[model samples]
Target: MPQVNLLPLPLIASTRAASNAIPGRRLRRFPGLYRWLLPAALLALWQAATSQHWIAAQVLPSPYEVWLTLDYLATSGDLWLNTAASVQRVVAGFAIGSLIGLVLGGAMGLSPTLRAYLQPSFNALVQIPVLGWFPFALLIFGIGEPLKYALIAHAALVPVTLGTMQAFRQAPQPLIEVARVNGFGRRQIISAVVLPAAVPVLFSAFRLAFTKAWLSLVVVELIASSEGLGYLIVYGRQLFQLDLVMASVVVVGAIGWLIDRGFTLAEGRLLRHRLTPGARP
Candidate 1:
């Protein structure tokens, strides 16, 4: 240290700028490479673990083995059919629950009368676990599709309703006043003012409800079903087909991820619409 000559902040900024410039120039060439890189690395790691026999191969099959089983399922068309069934059930449950939740929640949040009559019972019922409802669901609808739908719907609706109610209740007072001053009727106020303000929260509730519905479908299928992906896992477990089990697990995870991604995309589009030039009051 002949001399303490610190690089000036401007020079540090210039260096960073120069370094980033090269990557910026190369960005077009590497578009989307990072997207698949993480998954590939994970697959590689799993393959390495299986090769090293860190856990018994029979217990935790290699990535390739799982893929092969997946391929078999795919080729036979069973995977698509089963996946479609599970997806439909999730959609059905989410749709029904979200619709009812929005109406009930909006009423409860907006009017004191509705809240007084409904909130107590709804709050208490939410405490009951999804598993606990299975027995009653089975008794009500039997071991049929309706039973699963009923269970999934109940599991999903509570959170959605609660979230919607809270979100609507907390809409800015100034905005509400503005809506009324603009001669908006009660229906118009809710449609134009309250709903827009609460959209983000409502969508969040939808996402939660969808996740709950998906989980409920799996549980329902596992407990009382002849088909579906969860049934596939149950079958694999019973038959001691670890590869099949792992493959089915991977499928379930992938499907759930895809559903979430779809919802996120929809949320983004909806938000974009709400943010346009003249959307708000």
Candidate 2:
């Protein structure tokens, strides 16, 4: 047999060219940040417009005023306390809702009979606007923590269930056959093949569910409950405190941003191997 060369000249040249073409290794790895630059510019423009009173400061409190409000709230420990309470409630409700979504989704995904049985009702329920559930949730759970959980669960269930079921149904047939040829049992096939294959799609579902839970928390608070970021907005409205309302809006937007950031981190960690450039989330 002829001896083979371990290092091919062309391969070496290609690797060097790729490395040199990239701006930097770190920058290449984080192209996601580049897209956020536009949003950052928009924020600066908005801050300038508001701060200079280009618009009525009453209608749009300057970012500085909001920051000052935040600082005051922070010094009094009021911001932390209220934020902590809201966080706990939203997190708890989201966890339970996500769990339920995963279970029900798995059940339908794996079973044609179950899917047939549940599909119509599931589709119907999902079509109802989530905010419309507030009155019913209140009637059922009565202005308590249960209402929060119920409403969030309602918001989270659809995207997760649909994404999971659709992902599994669309799993590559060849991959399933490979698992079968290896003599894997149903559970083994699901654990080894289906879950890994479905994960990237499920990550998208998770992102949707988290957003739903966040918004649902606010809605429930505004309508029924006594506390949370939503309540902060409602309280401001009732008192005609536009600055408070504007401040709370900024806080809500900030919380949403942090939550999305957490998801991006989690996706990078969880789907490290499968994530590819330019793939749909």
Candidate 3:
């Protein structure tokens, strides 16, 4: 039997037209424009708020004032010095923590007995807030670089370990089977099959670990450092310079955003060939 149209011609045309327009209407297709809209709106609102005096200047300085303060800090090299210190600390801590996490997580993931033994204590220990470790760390490290590094490393370790464990455990079974069919040894199977499959998740873990390390850098500096963005914030507060504080905050946020964006771009490039056309991994 011949199939008949279920709708009128105009209705069909309209539906087709709407479907055709859908691609053009998708906001994510223009991600840069979409992403900037909110920030632009917020900036405008901030300008309005300050100009209209809706908020007191003492509490929240004008954006212009913050910009001026940021300019002054940059000119004086204070911003760069503090930012470099923070970055160095974050890099050192993240490297140490992530390396340890990968080793420990890999061992535990490969050996169920090891995981069973460590999982409970590991989970319990991670439950304590980063700040909760402060007293002990302070007593042991004495408000120095070691304390900052230890705390930052502690912050970075948990996520990377969990992510690495999950990544190893979740490697595609089909690939593992294929490797086994070829009589690949355990090490070869892991290196050739599991490692490639786990790259995406591992990258995510590293990104998260870096974020934690960066945040912990600020926290540690806030508690006991002479120089860093967090210390800059403290200095501004002590001097009652809201503009300076705001500038420091903006710099911190901007730097974190830039670094995270770099990671995201690198991940995209690294995994580009793995994804099918029009499909996300």
Candidate 4:
């Protein structure tokens, strides 16, 4: 099949030049260091405020107190248990949601008739926030694991579906015409041209979906769960243990940062390959 380069030569040359530049490496490293400045400042402020009693213990515990609480939870294994539960829910729901989204979105992209039939309803349904579905899901699933899964799945599904549809729809018409001129069939064209072109956008969609799923998982656990990081927060609040609440919040943030970093690395590798000259099929 004939392959067309949608990007101009000058753009490709510039990209290659930027990638090899010493300034680009410095620019990347600078951001990693620069991004920590604010967080460090915030931590310092937090510590000072608590140490000086500017904030009450009931309002916000000292950083040392939060650290002790985190250590205690870790030693007791409750932290690991709750963290695992939350991660498991997000992974399961995200997988199910993204799979279904890919199928539905692909079909819609391939068939205008199917898109016409489904797009309106999907848009209307997806407008409802995860919390808006909480009461309805609770009614149907009755505060069980299924309730949490349903909400998280819905959260993941909306973004992935929209992204997949857009990615497929945005495939260059010239490329499609070129594929057809080369006697490529529908499946061949999709596999050889469309999928490769859509990789970057699809990765972005997956990242967004995972974020939504993770957030929805926490919210669901907060409202309905007996155990999970969110439940740990609720439990801490009920007992007026601000330190435990802070510890759980810290764990949540840390996990989110780690997962986002993982996504970034994965995206960087895939995009590096995709952006390489003569890489596309």
- The per-model lDDT (C-alpha) reads 0.88, 0.82, 0.90, 0.90
TM for candidate 2 is 0.79
Candidate 3 pairs with clashing backbones: none
Query: Model 4, poorest ten-residue lDDT window?
Result: 272-281
What value of lDDT does candidate 2 attain over all alpha carbons?
0.82
Model 4 lDDT per residue over 1-281, tens place = 99998999999999889878967788677867768889999999999999999998899999999999999999999999999999999999999899999998888877899999999999999998999988888899887888888889999998889989998998888999999999999999999888888888889999999988988888888888899999999999999888988999999989988988999999999888877898753
Residue 73, model 1, lDDT: 100
Using alpha carbons, what is the TM-score of model 4? 0.87
Off by over 4 Å in 2: 1-54, 275-281
- In candidate 2, position 275 carries an lDDT of 69
Least lDDT summed over 10 consecutive residues: which range in candidate 1? 272-281
Candidate ranking under lDDT, highest first, comes to 4, 3, 1, 2
What's the true lDDT of residue 191 in model 2?
83
Error of 3 at 113 (Å): 0.6
TM-score of each: 0.85, 0.79, 0.88, 0.87
Q: Cα RMSDs of all predictions? A: 3.3, 9.9, 5.9, 11.7
Model 1 per-residue lDDT tens digits across residues 95-147: 88888888889889999898999999998988998889888777889888888
